[model samples]
Target: MSEQQGRQRVDVTLSINGKSYTRHVEPRRLLADFIRHDVGMKATHIGCEHGVCGVCTVRIDGRTARSCLHFAVALQGHEIETVEGLSADGRLERLQQAFHEEHALQCGFCTPAVLLTAEEFLAENPSPSDSDIRAALSNNLCRCTGYTNIVKAIARASGREGEAASSGTGDAS
Candidate 1:
């Protein structure tokens, strides 16, 4: 660790989207900043720097967490997953495709975190009710599309294509 501007800086090595990144950062540097600035992965957006908003959500060791709430130094040697890693073969994941087809995203600020959250939710609950999908995404905040399309997209991705179609009337505005 070295001193920079009276704050201690340390070296951290972590994996993001299957790529290893080694960066020297301040002890107080949030993982969100580290991912965006140090690692050059801009898919992770920061909102409500206080962690209440889920825009900065990312997977730490396969579990969703608020990146803004964690320190970069504490994540040394940990595996991190961002939206950029969702499609390793240059094809959209099921959820991503559904989001596009269902029009789940508008403005797209919260789409990445929402997609990550819904991915984990659907993995754990493959056949979820509309209510269940809404519950799973309650933590994420989206100002566009009214969350109707987002739920439909998640439902569609979970293999409930008919149910997703029946629940919604038209595309979300």
Candidate 2:
């Protein structure tokens, strides 16, 4: 534990996006806060504070977990992956590209979480069906697209579907 602003804090070392970060935080500090405020990465969005919304999702030790549900101290020595880490050469990754091509995002609040979740799902199931894609995305909430385009984007990323005929058009619900 360390002293910060006259308050007690615990030191946590987190490996995020292939980088290591050590910060003193309160025991109650959420992993999402640590990643965003302490580590200075903004790709992980905080939504619903509770675990009901997957907006705070990140890959912990290669598995998708809600950052809002875990304490910063609990993530010590664990690897975390945010949407910012998914790309190489600063260009959007294939999954992100698919989301763009399929017009999977609107308002853009839930894109990062959905992208992270889709990355994990594709890694585990490279050839998922449309139903499988829908099942995987069920945890993340997107008020804009009604999930049809999101499912199609995942399907395209997984090689289960072809390129979308058009872009930015809302899909059939």
TM-score for all models, in order of appearance:
0.89, 0.85
Q: What is the TM-score (0 to 1) of candidate 1?
A: 0.89
Once fitted onto the true fold, the runs of candidate 2 whose alpha carbons sit more than 4 angstroms away are 1-6, 89-92, 162-173
- For model 1, the superposed segments whose C-alpha errors exceed 4 Å read 1-5, 90-92, 162-173
Candidate 2 achieves a global lDDT of 0.81
In order, the Cα lDDT scores of the candidates are 0.85, 0.81
lDDT value for model 1: 0.85
Count of steric clashes across candidates, in order: 0, 0
User: With candidate 1 superimposed using the best TM-score fit, by how many Å does residue 93's alpha carbon deviate from the native?
Assistant: 1.9
The sequence of per-residue lDDT tens digits that candidate 2 reaches over residues 80-141 is 88888877455347787888888888899889888888888888988876667777878998
- Screening candidate 1 with a backbone cut-off below 3 angstroms (N, C-alpha, C), the clashing residue pairs are none
Clashes of 1: 0
At residue 41, give the lDDT of candidate 1: 88
Best by TM-score: 1
For residues 51-153, could you state the per-residue lDDT of candidate 1 as single tens digits?
8879999999999999999998898878899989976754347888888988888999999899889888988999998878877887898887778888888
